[model samples]
Target: MDMEKEMFDIIHTSEFSIFSLSQLPHDDNSLLLGYEGKVKSFDGRTGKIIDLWEMHEQRVNTIDVHPGNSNLVATCSADGFVRIWDLRCLGKEQPKSIKEVAHNRAVQSAYFSPTGNGLVSTSTEDTIRIWGGPHFENLSIVKHNNKAAGRLSSFSAIWGWNDSYIFIGNIQRAIDVISTENNITTPLKSEYMTNVPCRFATHPYKEGLLACAGGGKLFLWTKM
Candidate 1:
């Protein structure tokens, strides 16, 4: 027996490989993409370029949308920086990044907090950074091992249900929770965990429920 497989080209305008992309809020057709060291917006439904601009000196690793503000987005890059951009300033301005920081040697990813009031970034330089306040000048850097997980998923400092706690994996085969308020590190270890939890996800509506995956293993955690 033979099984037929088919593939369709949904986008044709972009000649370069897209590293990361995010759909603009409130508009299903609008999309933002990071490719060839540039930030670009294209019509998702039509596959037409809406706009393009030079964004970073190196590859953009991730594009994250603000949880509260549709107009705000964040991008992390191997250029060692994380920048915050305003979607509202699209055609009116070039280089719409309102805030940016030289986080590390290579930032793996950046994410806005659940409230959109704070930002966090994970870097390959073995550090986790937190930025907040009006100017985003209030910064705290926590030293941690964030090296690439060989043959496994790398670690990302993910926010829990709220903006106060960040969940990440440690070399001790346990989960580490970093407090945003005081910049403290706490470990969550269990006898059942056999491997490191490199990637994380928290229930948006649940307070303590957490999940992490690494080495093709998943662990669900809850405060006892």
Candidate 2:
């Protein structure tokens, strides 16, 4: 990959009242910018504010687009809610609908399933909840870690090679290989980095090579 090439041509720049950025799927040319309790979609080419949607009555934390389909995206807020949007039907005579109350707490990550049929999100409650459907309905909940007071520090990321497996990450910087066929979650061999992993990505064309980064460091690994 040419790191020198511009990713998203920074179509717009605005002040946000939040902590992080909620980006749309890379394949698409749109970005969802969250600020002070609302969400807006910006054009990736011209940096024009194309569409806007209200997600919460309070501040929002993050937004994420679906991996397979760019039309669908997810958002989480400080008000402890996760919402999904279908951008395809926006601003029509009868536009698409948004799903609110998707989660119970301040969500950390709201991610779509690799197959685009379902989604998974993590909360401050220390539980990972999975939802189904392109419409996004509740499906299953995975509770493995203990909850702590005053915002427990946790990191949860998912990597989907296919519908069969999703690699999950934890605060200790270790990963769990989740088998979607049987819902079996197994921890992978630890990388032993200096800090916990904050991001995950796979090779564009190679199936076994994977990359992860955290704490100002990057690491690449290949499956044998």
Q: Give one clash count per candidate, in the order shown.
A: 0, 1
Best by TM-score: 1
Angstrom error at residue 88, model 2: 4.4
Residue range 1-224, candidate 2, lDDT tens digits = 23688464435666655444556655366667777777776776776877766656677666777777777777776677877777776663334447865456667667666677777676767667777765665477777452332343345546566656666555565566666566678876554565555567778688878786766677676899
lDDT of 2 at 109: 65
What's the TM-score of each model vs. the native?
Answer: 0.85, 0.75
How much does candidate 2 score in TM-score?
0.75
Highest lDDT: give the candidate number: 1
Poorly placed runs, candidate 2 (over 4 Å): 1-11, 18-29, 67-69, 88-96, 133-135, 146-154
Error of 2 at 77 (Å): 2.3
Query: Given candidate 2, what's the lDDT at residue 176?
Result: 63
RMSD each, Å: 4.3, 4.1
